[model samples]
Each structure stands twice: as C-alpha cells, then as structure tokens.
Target chain A: MTSQTMRRRFAATTNDLLDTDPRVALTLADIGVGSFNGRNHPDRIINVGIREQLLIGATAGLALAGLRPIAHTYAPFLIERPFEQIKLDLSHQDLGAVLVSIGGSFDAAAEGRTHQAPGDVALMATLPDWTIHVPGHPDEVEAMLRRAATSDDRVYMRLAADTNTSPHPATGELAKIRTGTARGATAVAVGPMLDRVLAATEHLDINVLYAATVRPFDAATLREIAQAPEVILVEPYLEGTSAAEVSHALEDRPHRLLSIGVPNTEHRRYGTRRHHAAAHGLDVGGLRTRIEEFLR
Target chain B: MALTTAPPAVHEYEELGRLMSLMTGDEKHSAAATSTLDVIWALYDQVLRIDPTRLDDPARDRFLLSKGHGPMAYYAVLAAKGFIDLDTLTSFATYESPLGHHPDSNLVPGVEIASGSLGHGLPIAVGLAIGLRARGNPARVYVLLGDGELDEGSNHEAIAVAGRRHLDNLTAIVLDNQSASRGWPGGIQGRFSVEGWAARRVNGRNHEALTQALTTPHDGRPLAVVASTEAGQ
Candidate 1:
C-alpha cells in the first residue's frame, strides 16, 4: 500500500486539474497553500487568508460566473463554520462548487475538538441536493475530485488520514464485497471504516458492502443486496449519519438497523486517531463484539 | 393586461415612486427601500452597461443587492430598465409572485444573487470579480450593501481581498443611513480606503453625485462609494 495520505492526493489531483482545465478553479483559506502555489494557473488558485466565509463565498461567485470552483479547508472551517455561506451562497443561489475538506471526525485527535468535525456529515445532510463522498483510500481521491470538477454539482469530498490498505473503484454505489451464509446479517462499511469492518466481521456470516458516497444514498442497490431484515451501518463520521437513509430504504418491510460510528459525547482526551476510534467502540475488537451481540 | 408606453428616462425618479407604491406589505422596509431608491435608479438609467434583452450575456454588468431587505427600490429599478413587467411589481412578496421581500436570482430575471442574509453579497462579488477577470471578461460587478450590513465580519474579509487583488472592475455602493449599532470610527470610506479601494462619499439622493461616483475609474484598485441618506426611520 502506498503511504500517500488522502489530503496529499486531493491536493495533487486539484493541482493537475488546474493545469489542464480552464473551468476548474480552487479557493483556499490559508490552508494547503504551499502545496498548490506556483502552479501553472496562479490566477485560478485564490487563497482567501483564513476566511472560510470568503472561501465558500468566492467559490460560489466563481460558480455563478460559470466556472467550476473547488473550495478547500479543514472539516470544521470548511463545513461547520461557514455553513450558512454554503447554504445561501451555493445552495440557495442554485450554483454548484466542489467543497473538498480534510480531517475526518477525529483525524486530528491530538489537536483537540476544535480541529475535529464529527458532525460534518450530519450538518451537510440538512441541505438538499448535495453529493457527499467519503473516500476510504488515497487512490479514490483523484477520480472523485475529477468527476466533481468536470460537472456542476454541489459535492463535499471528505478526505481523512485513515485509509484502507486497498483501493476500491470510486463508484458512488454500494459495492457488495462479502456474502453471508443464509443472509444472516448485512453490514455497510462507509469510507475508511472498510478495513476495520472487514476484520471485525471476517469470521462471522455477515454480508458487507462498501460506500464511498453517502448522499443520494444508493437505495436501490441496498434493497437488492440486503436479503435479511437485520442491517448494521458502520460509518467514519457521526454514528448514525446514514441511519435515516438506511431506514427509509427498508421502510416498506420490517427491518432492524444497528448504527456504529463515533459517539456524540466529547471524550476530552487528546491522543491518536486509533485511540479515539477505540474509545468510541469503533476498533476491531470493539466492533467484533458489538456485531456478534447484535447478531445473537 | 395591455401594453403600456415606456416612461421617459427623466421621469424615472417619479416613476420609481409610483412603481414602489404598487407593492404594499407588512415588510415594506420603507426606510431601507427609500434610502437606496436614487442610487438604484441612477445605476440602471446611466451607469450599468446592461440590456434586458441579453440577460445571459457574459459581458453584461452584474448587479448584486447585498442588502436584500425592502427590495422595492431594486424591483422598481429592474422594472424601469425593462427587466420585468411593471405589473409584476403589484404582486411583490405574494405567494405566486416572483418578487419576494428579498430578491431571488433564480426566480427574478436580472437578479444576480439571492441575498437577504447580510454580508453574503460582497464576498460573492469578490469571487465574481476574480472569476470575471481571470476569464478575461470585461464586465463590471456592482454590489449594493447597507451601512448596518458592514457589521457582518464577512464584508471585511471581502473588502480586504478585493483591495489586495486590485479588482478594478468591482464597485461597492454602501447606502449609509447611520443604522449600524457600532459605526465606523473614521467613517465607512476609511474602512475601504485603508485597504486600497478608491473611496468616495456622496448624498445618496443626489443623482449627479451617484452617477459620477458609480462610473469613476479606479485604475488597478476596486471602488467603494458611501452614499449617505437620512437617518433610518
């Protein structure tokens, strides 16, 4: 597995897009400036100097001018802080832009809560017509960014420090990876949680599916693949981020869903991402125990 | 609905009063609407290089109303310039009316951005200036803001960046009715001038002053015109 982080891959892909596509523009808020500076199209790359509102506002302006703008920053600043800008400027104006953010849930655990945004996906769910992509590997970053740049859609590409050892195709569909015996239980692993989920349910008879895109949730595929009434959703962000989508898809029949992800309570302890995951019962041992209990 | 004769350009001021009177509602925002009436009229009649026929023209001047409250003046100007029907003004803020208290760009022809939330337009205008300049389009971008709207920190972010970028094609018209809870210490012009914008102060009601200020050449820097009206009602 290549050691490249998703953030680096996103920056590299964005830089390449800027070099080739005239319609592709990037707006920054004093984050990752060094990686993108001195590119072929300096005018297309704008750094708003730590102003997240302007980051989204300027990106919307570019979109209004018929250009595909990509706005980048940390998760909190990119999604949480200037959310109104995202809602009003981009959504309300009926314009489109690619919002690529770094720092998944607790990726920056050592930096404390301010640097983390566990609620990013939940907040984005409130807005309509947004394509939310949470890629599990660095290899998936380029394709997602490219698709968003070439089209006029409101996309939120979340890049995290945690990555799966292997790269799955960047299809926004739910790809069924494992087959369970007699369809005992179906577990959906989102983004970076694929590796841990695979390990946890390895010895069990649970069907597993991988998702890179959460919004516009692939309801059709889930309904087809989910042969059993029991479903377990494991996400990298807030635990129940995709619970509503799952429930809505299976509402016609009697079904049970167990959501597993980061908890809502603040741990208040600064450590590594692994530590945070373990604390939230998202580690392999914790996940295996929880899934087995639900199955029994 | 029969076709009516177009009003003469000189009577547009009185035409605006009549146009504004057509719309009546609980949220007229009369003070805010009246303060900006003269400036809006002057821009559509004299300053803006726009045509109602070519709404999608890339070279057409873009006007974004940042202060979207009490948009009767804006709707009146848009109607006076042939962007919308005069009859539509009578249905402003109605359930079926395209005209809302705050203009929606999607619903309203010729409206650029949907704004009622303060401090959003200036930042968006900055992006427009940058995108337009990069694409080599010669169209100018104008944004109308209220003095109270400046209290939103987002405007300052736009002001600072527009100045640093030297966006000559961007102009900000601030209707100052002295309504901000905390006023600018040296005045609104200083806040913009300090950041390299060509700043000016004029009586918002003075047609000659507004026309000159709006059309002034700013060379390599952006322009800011502080048009003072009477104290807010």
Candidate 2:
C-alpha cells in the first residue's frame, strides 16, 4: 500500500462491471490494449476501427437507448478531434455515459507527442457537467469504476499508465484518498503518474491526495483537503489542461496552488510519458526534490 | 397504417403560400429552406396515407429528413397537412422552441431523430425501413437528404447499405441544392455527373417531377432524386 503497485485492480473492476451489469455496453474505438482485454464480451463490444467520432456517437446512441455505455479510447482522439461531438452529442446531452479515458498526461510515452493527452483534463473538466477523478494508483481505478458503474452520472475517468506504479489503499474509495493525511503538504496528482510524485517528494511531510473525478467535483471535499496555503497540482498535460488552471480557479478562495505537468517547452519532444516525466522530474524523486526546495 | 393527413382540398400553390405567410419570418424561412414546398405538398396530397391528428402513430409511414437543415420546407408541409398548428411555426428557433435550426427529435412533434449534421439522417432512415421489413409492418421510410451533405461519407454508406438490402419500402430524396451552408460548391448535380450516377436531375422546384419520383416505387435499388434549388428559396 505504501509503494506503487496497482494497475490490475482497475482493469479487473472494469471487466467485472461489464460482466455483471446487463445494461452496460462499451464501444472499443479500435483499442485492444492498455488495461482492457477486449475479449470475453460478445457483439455488445463494438470495435470501431479508429473512428473516434463514430465511436463517441455510437456510445451516445447506445446510451440514449437505455444502455450504460463506456467509451474508452486513446485520450487525444477521445477528447480532441471529436470535440464537437463530445460537446454536443455526449457532454451537452449529459447522457450519463462513462468516458473511460486512458493515457493521461505523459502516459502515452512510447507513442510520442500526438498520442500524449496533455490538454484533456483541462479541456474536459471545464465543460458544463463533468466529473473528473485521477486516481494515484490501481486500487483507486477499481474503486472509481465501481462508483461510476452504480451512478447515472456522466463521468470522465482520466486513466493512469496501465503498466506501472499501482496504489491500493486499504480503505479504497477516492474520498478516502483525498481525506488521507499528507506526509508533507498535499501534493495533488492528477494523471496516472501519482507514483512519481510519491517517489519524488518523500522527504517533505508527504501525504498523497488522489482526486480522480474530473467534474461534479466534491467541492467541499476539495476545499477541505486543499486547505494548505501551499498546494501543488500535478497532471500529465500542459498549462491549460492539467491541474494548474484548476488551481488558479480555486485561487479565488484560498490555497497557494502550483501547477506541474509536461511543460510547454517539452510538448513537441519525443519519448514515452514515463521518460518525459523522468526527464522533467515528474517521477517520484524529481517531485520529491521539488517539494523539498519549494518548502525550504 | 391509418392515413389521416389528408391534403387540404384542391388549394392552389398561391393559396398554400398565403396560408404559410400567416406565420412569422423565421418560421416561414425555416419552412421555405428544406425542399421546394411542392414536393411536400405532393407527398401529403396524393401519396402518403396517415392521420394528421395521429402524427406519432408507429403504423404510419415514416418521413425522415436526413437533410435536417431542410426543415425550412418540412415545417410548411407539416402545417399544410395540419400535423401542427400553423401558428406554432412562428416560434421557430426561439428558446425552447421545438422548431430548432436542426430537428430535435425529443422536442419537435413528428420528428424521428435529432439531426443537422450532414451524415446522420440516412442511418436512422435505414433503421426504420429495416425495422418495418423485419416486423412485416408495411410502413415506408422516406428520407430527404441534401446533395451537399454527401460531403459527409456516412450518408453514402447508408445509401450503399440500403441498396444492398433491397429495402423497397424505403425512399431517399436528395435535395441537390449543391451549396454547403450559404456558399461553397453549389452543384451537387454537377458533382454526381462525374460518377455518372444513372441519376435524374430535375427542377427541384418542379412539382410533377418531384412528386412522380418521390411517389413511384423503385424496381430495384434506393432512389436518389437530385433536385437543384437556389439558396434561401
């Protein structure tokens, strides 16, 4: 629980949700890898080869017809190209379909920049009715999907890198993670890159708050946890999309919010998200070092 | 299917225009913009059998506007057929108005789907035709598509799918204004000339051509009647 090791928990939960809930359907926008097995389900799982717009629209159609549709695709195509569809067909209607997004921030490390979903968190959460949850580890992913499965609420899950650093808390809900004590100041991790933050800033009175729900924020809960005058926001995207904008928006009330993610300079760079994170010190040690200096 | 929407008795196009003028400008424009009103008048007058009072009856033939923006003409047809109050046309596109720029299936009376996007309508039309064929229900699915909307590929896919399936009960009318929005290439009939689509380009404004093509049963393949029209007509 103390270290990172939780990717499987999230996948298992999603598979279980699809298995048990008869009304739940998922459109696999041609993605077979990264957390989802794409097997086990029958014709119900629609594999639309690389058509993000149709994929999203199909999900909306299925949802309108009394199905709980979960559309999971690469983050960039999911929110960027088909943005008009998202804003109109899905988000505007508030169809209550769960948008299970994978590859937040630098998660698309090997695929390079076009694949890195640096602006998604910023773009999506700003919409009228969205609930964003960025879990720090795998256990949180499981718990988040569980909660999402039960509600008719339209949710956008910013997924973590499926292979690395899993966080499983004994008391497993997102609310529990946010309410947990900070080992130092609360370092808010927004993407699947939470383990990097934990590994980096261990010396500071470090307690990790894994807030994953993007919209329909538990504002009271956020305000309560982010009470510290010094708060740092971490996500895998750039300035507009990651936690920085969120930090600034919350600036009106209180809290000293510092935003961190892929810097503007590194946007066009080559490498995987993990490499970029490590290069820019998004990893645990890099984050740990920054906190020590910032607090000092 | 109970046919209730009887065409108003022998009203001249001039009289029909006068009946339409009773509504406000936006409503009239909305009605005017779809296809030439004559096509709609012919459908209600000579062909389709349905009670205007029972607009939502599933047994009735389904008329879908794949050219969703063409509601300009469609609204007047509904009014002329008495499917909706002629006065309700005045509230077109206002807040909460059922007559929006694009049809909202939920709000608009007799609308089958929410559409304004170019490629969306045909699929729903295909669904309707398929459903009726499957259920052994005799309802015909009529879809009006604009030529410019072929800029969207999905409409093409729908045409291909329908033809392959031999859905004799389904009819698709392509409004070949050849214009995308206010400007752009305005000759869809010109574009289709390249494929050498064994097509019939008629004066979209001409009532007889529109009606005969619309009402006549196809021996094989779905019908694509490309009618040329001026913008803002």
Candidate 3:
C-alpha cells in the first residue's frame, strides 16, 4: 500500500465522531465478522444483526425521534432488498440517515457476485438532492466520514473494497478532491478508480479530474474541467447507452465525452473487479489507450 | 357543528344485523373482525362532523386507518355511514374494489395512508397534524393502529416525537387485537408500550371506555387510547 492510501481509513474518523456527539449513533448491521465497530462505546454501537430492513427502518425511526444515526452494512443486499423501506422511511420522510454501503464492485470477488453492488452508485445518484460520496482513496474516506457525521442531509457514501493505502486529503479541498486538472484530456474518475485514471494519463497530453461528491456534481467544477478539449465520465455502475447524455450535457462545448462503466448485461463471467475493469477499459493503461486513440 | 355522540344505537344494531346477514358465513373470519367496530361506529355515528354526501370536504376531520387490514369492520362502518353507495361487503377481496383487503390512501377516498404493512400510519398522521397545527386550523387528525404493530420501531419513534412536540390535535387509537396475525399468538396488549397505554386494558365493545379515552383533552400533549377487543366481539 502507498503512503497516500494510508492517509484515509474510516475507523479513526468514525471513532472521533461517535465519541464527540452523544446524539450521534453508529448502527452496525451484521457484516464481515469482527468489524472494528463497538470500540467507541458499546451503547453507542447498535448491532441490528443481519436485518437490513430493520436496520434502515429503525434508523429512520431513531432519526425521527431526535437522534442521528449512521447505519453501516454491505452494499448489494441493503441497497436492493430493503429499497422500499429506504425510499419511504428515509427519503420520503426526509428524515436523514447516513448509509455506509461497503464492499462495492470487485471487492466482492472473494465472496461472490451476490455481494457485489456496482449498480448502487447510479441508483443512489438519481435520488434528488442526496449526497453521493465515492471516495477515490482511503484519505477521502476519512474526510468523508467527518462530513457524514456532521452533515444533516442524506448522504450515501459508496465505499470501495480496496483497503490499500492512499493519500488522505490534508485540506478540505483535497479532503474530497472535488475538481482538478490532470494534463491532456479531462478524465473525471470516481471511487478509488482514480489510480487507474492517473496511470492511464502517462505518455499523453490529457488532463484528469476526480469527483468525490457525485450527487450535486459541482456544476462549476465540471464547467472548469470541460475547459479541456475532451472529457470522460467514470462510475462503477453500468452505463446503459447514456454515454450520449454525458456528451449532450456538454453539447455546447467542442469536446467528445465518453462514459467508462459496466455495460447493461448480466455479466456472464464471474471474476475479479480488476478483470471487469480491464475488459470494460477502466484500467490506467486502458484509459490512457482510449485517450490516445480518441485524441489522435 | 360541535362534535356530539349518538345514544341508544338500536338503529346501529339493526344496521349490524343487515351487515352480518349480507356477510353470510365465516369464510375469512368476518364475524371475528370486530376490533375496530365500536371505534369506527363511534367516529362515524357521533364524533365526526361529516356528511356522507360531502366525504371529501376540506373542513372534515381526518380519520386514518392505521390498522388498514381491519377492513372486515371498516367496510361495514363505511357502508353503514354511506361512504360508498351500497353495503357491498361481498365485493371485498374481489376485483378492483375501492377497498383492497388493506386500505391504500391513494386508492380509497377516505383513507389517508396505505397501511397493510402496519406501523406506518402514525408518522404520516403526525406529519398531517404538524401541518394542520401550523396552519392554525381546528381540523383534528385521528389514527387507529393495531396494538400488535407497536412492536415495530416506527411506532415508538413516532409516539415519542409527537409527545415531545405536544401535538394535542392528534389522537392515536390503538386497536389492541393482541395477535399480529392469525395463529401468531395473542395476549393482553398495549400501544406504543408507553406508560399511559399500559395503565389498563380496554374493552373494545364498551362505548364508554372509548369515549373516556378519545374525548379526553390532550392539553398540548399527544393522546393515546389502547382500545382492546376479543375476536368475536
């Protein structure tokens, strides 16, 4: 792991937030055994146990009753199974709760496809006004945990499975890595997928952009990134022919925008996230190649 | 007009008589579905200042069936009160009836929240109450939830928040039917599991017991009435 990866880890941020505020609660759904929860305070840690519906429903209830809750669980099951409860209880009621949907995408190869939730990012992104946080590296994860605990609105932080070291943001600007320039064409990468974006920019005259917050994609930031000749959108969820929508949003500009994400198919082959990343042209080398070809 | 109670319901008895005759037999536990019988009749017959001809009036008091599946009795009361044209109790659980086995506020005109899933109505009711109170209107809100659904975490949070807010305009009625579902075990039950609800068991058929609870002035705090009943009441 790189020194940059060590910069962000959720454990410390979560511990500090739970300790500082008595109103704040950390609810741990029965996830990977021996999760580093409950160290803050047992009473502060609510183990709802294998019940995703109960976890979300109870958290909404608790929030309604004047308590702030951070409900943590695996992504695939909670995002899909109890979607109705989440939609009605949390979203419809507008009673905010922070959801930590962990083990996204290839992080599930060790378990199986059932545990992978690549689609959640796109589904969650559609909920109007909700904060969609996909931390690129561990440092961003730490910065985001602080934001999640303090922010009063609904925030869905789609955390990646990679525990590898990455640089945490020292300032609020890098804390999220909202909007930045690379070198050649503008490449906007989300989650830890920035590693691939950075790698792909080699031997090229392209610029790169990393988005920490997905929902209210800082329009100003995107406009700045669009200052470049071309732009690419990266997400873990499948992009179903909406590649044109990305281009259309920037139709006024003289740029060819391409979306890099999972395809609209049931993925016949089951393998590592890296494998899917490679086939879908999401790797650093693949992205660099795509840029070189497009720019040429 | 000020809300008042009806006395000597021999007229009510005759209506129930016709309802039972039309219901015919015990296929889906029709006779046993009397948990909200007296509560519905009480609201429809006396307390509610509403006209059957003007069911959707803006000034009318809102009655939400939190225990929506209690329609075995709700339809009977609605028919008796003329919310619908006929006492078409036979069409229950049939094709495209305004009445589903459970009430969807979206479908049924008089219904407020679609609640077959239980423990859902009160929060919405609280929302309605808060909005109405903010508007400085006298329209009161009533939500009737099953005692069994108090086990749901939603109920506890709703009650605590409403109570803390002193929402006097909202009256929450708990139908202590004892069982969450058929053959799911039954017992002496309460609502919201709060101190006031646990103080006593209610007699569902006893009009006076409900009257004492429902009519009590909430004095700025939300009111809860644990109205209990037996299967065949």
Best by DockQ: 1
Candidate number that wins on TM-score, 2 or 3: 2
Model 1 C-alpha lDDT per residue in residues A1-296, reported as the tens digit of each score: 23389988888888888988999999999988988844577679999999999999999999878889999989999999999999999998889999999986999999999999999999999999999999998889888988888899999999999889988898899988888865668899999999999999999888899999999899998888787899999999898999999999999988999999888887798999999999999999999999999989
Query: Per-residue lDDT of B1-233 in model 1, one digit per residue for the tens?
Result: 11112233433667788888998993549988998898888788778777787889898889899999999989988888788999899998889999998899999998999999999999999999999988999889999999999999999999999999999999999999999998889999999999999999999998888888887678999999999999993
lDDT by residue for model 2 (A195-240), tens: 5666666545545665455455444545556555666766666643
Estimate, for each residue in B1-233, the C-alpha lDDT of model 2 and write its tens digit: 21325546434455666655544445533533645566566566656767666766666876766666646556666766666667767776678567776677667666655777767666556544554554456777677776667667655545555565566776666665555554336345444333322245667777777776666556654555677677545
Give each model's whole-structure lDDT: 0.90, 0.62, 0.63
Candidate 3 runs further than 4 Å off = A1-8, A36-40, A163-184, A240-251, A268-271, B1-233
C-alpha lDDT of residue B154 in model 2: 58
Per candidate, the number of residue pairs that clash is 0, 50, 19
The residue-level lDDT of candidate 1 at B182 comes to 88
Q: How many backbone clashes does candidate 1 have?
A: 0
DockQ, every prediction: 0.81, 0.17, 0.07
Which residue pairs come into collision in candidate 1?
Answer: none
Most TM-score-accurate candidate: 1
Model 3 chain A lowest lDDT segment of ten: A170-179
Residue A93 displacement in candidate 3 (angstroms):
0.8
